[model samples]
Target: MSQRSYRTAIVGTGAIATAHARAVRAATDRADLVAAVDIDVDRARAFAETWGVPRSFASLSELLLEEKVDVVHICTPPQQHAGLAIECLAAGVTAVVEKPPTLSLAELDELVAAESRSTAHMATIFQHRFGSGAVRLRRMAAEGELGRPLLATCDTQWYRDEAYFAVPWRGKWENEGGGPTMGHGIHQFDLLLSVLGPWEEVTAVAARRARPTETEDVSMALVTFESGVVASVVNSVVSPRETSVLRFDYENATVELEHLYGYTDKNWTVTPAPGHDGLVDRWAADTVSVPSGHDAQLAAVYDALDAGEAPPVTLAETRRTMEFVAALYASAFTGERVRCGQIGADSPFAKRMDGTGTPWGKVTAQ
Candidate 1:
């Protein structure tokens, strides 16, 4: 790794921004949190003071002109991701953007095109993939030690009330994208896809359920992967007993993780089949504890940059995950199965997630 310390800045002083600040600070030997930016100048100043960042700005333009930053962490809402990431790429600075990296596939394509022309690249914050248990599971699957994957389930059942959607951008199709499926469940499902590989087809259904929002409060889908693994996915903001759960049932054993948000090694459990009990020793031996969060991911990101390699959760990987999201929405809205690469430039879902407008009537109330 190069010994050079990366100068980093964070945009958006929201709740997630504090996590980014801490992650940057945690990697202090390799990165310096030089600046913080937010549309609210007071929040920006307060964030900088709290994080001990040297500077604060009200806009990306001001931050870029004033400081020489090597990397930018974009903690802004879904709608602003593409524009801000594009700006960072154009300025020859790497961008580490939050989940639901762009509002739509078309916007993501624009960011991808911008990255191709610049030395800088963009990585989405799919922090679950950085966890040690997830990494080990992925490695085992790749090595065939986990045996043939058969069935898997990913559930992101969390409750969000009217107060949560009271925020201006919380529930709109144009701003926050599509409720729980896009924002909440993307984390667990991204980890699922990382293990299962490419998905082939998806059939889904969505409903407004209990939330007062323009987007669906709950969605369920059946996903068929190229590896012959069939997975059931549920994304919801209406569940009273909130949990983020993923279970993979392979021929040899069943690997499962049960956690609300972030998870450590303790959150994972393995149940080997009758003849595969020996696999337990292997799992126990490879115990490297790393939780799923921005700190773990940011450390890996800086390390990749130092080695002149594409960071984890590259734009291509993120694109696949986002496309899967679009496919889910398309399938749910149109009542038809959507396949991989089916939603392209001409597809309605590509342009907008609500897809030819919501079939269940538009949400008038906030």
Candidate 2:
């Protein structure tokens, strides 16, 4: 890294912001949390005092002008990501934005464009990619040790109540982008795309089985990878208990990662394809380990800075992830198979956030 310490500012003081701060402190010898900003001045000040930040700002603009920060960790909600990230880029500050990045593909594109025009590098937090188990799976798949891939599946089910939706923008399409799909599902969906490669097409169905929100609590999508491997993704906020799982079926072997913190694989199964018992045995002998979600990603960022290279997760990759999200929405809404590249400029879901008052099940598909 540069000899000078990196002056860092956290722009949101929520629970996740605290997690990011701790991760930063653990990961970077050269990074210092100089400021914390929140719309609520009292919360900002409290966070600053607790975290030992030198300053706190009531507004991001104030923080940008006064804090002299070199990097910003944006922990704001999904709706606020685009505007704040764009503003930071415009002001010549590199930023690490929270996941989902924005509520729509159009906003994601604008942020990408802004980053390209600025000297400051930008990245999104797809922290699951940093897990050692995830890395091993990707590596094994790439090395063809798993042989031809047949199919993949991701299941994410978690519980959230009306109280959770009491947060002002939690249920709104304009704010959260969608309920479980963008919020709960994006994590594993991003991981799936990371391991399986780019998606070719998608068709989906969604519903609000229980949550009192304006977005779906349950959604299922059929995705086809560019390599012709098919996958099924299921996301839900109505399950009694929380669980996340990913399974991969290959011609030579079947691999699986099933864990509560889906990112960390404490349990894995690799079934050998007939004569490939040796390969499976070798993989089984090799251990997989990694820091938890936030820590691993932060450490990776520190490493990139140390090596004078871009962060592990780039804006282009984030944009592609967002496009996948857009295609899911398109498929869910239109009841037709939508191609990945087709979710470009003219896509209906682009910049279209109809925050109608009706709950998810009541809103007719457009």
The weakest ten consecutive residues by lDDT in model 2 span 353-362
The CA-based lDDT of model 1 is what? 0.92
Give per-residue CA lDDT, model 2, range 240-349, as digits (tens). Answer: 88888888999888888776654455666788888988876677666757744888887777667667776768887887788877777777777779897886576567
TM-score, predicted candidate 2 vs. hidden true structure: 0.93
- TM-scores of all candidate predictions against the true structure: 0.98, 0.93
Which residue pairs collide in model 1, if any?
none
Candidate number of the best lDDT: 1
Which residues of candidate 1, in runs, are more than 4 Å off? 362-366
- Candidate 2 regions with alpha-carbon error over 4 angstroms: 1-4, 284-288, 353-366
Q: What's the lDDT for residue 16 in model 1?
A: 95
Most accurate candidate by TM-score: 1
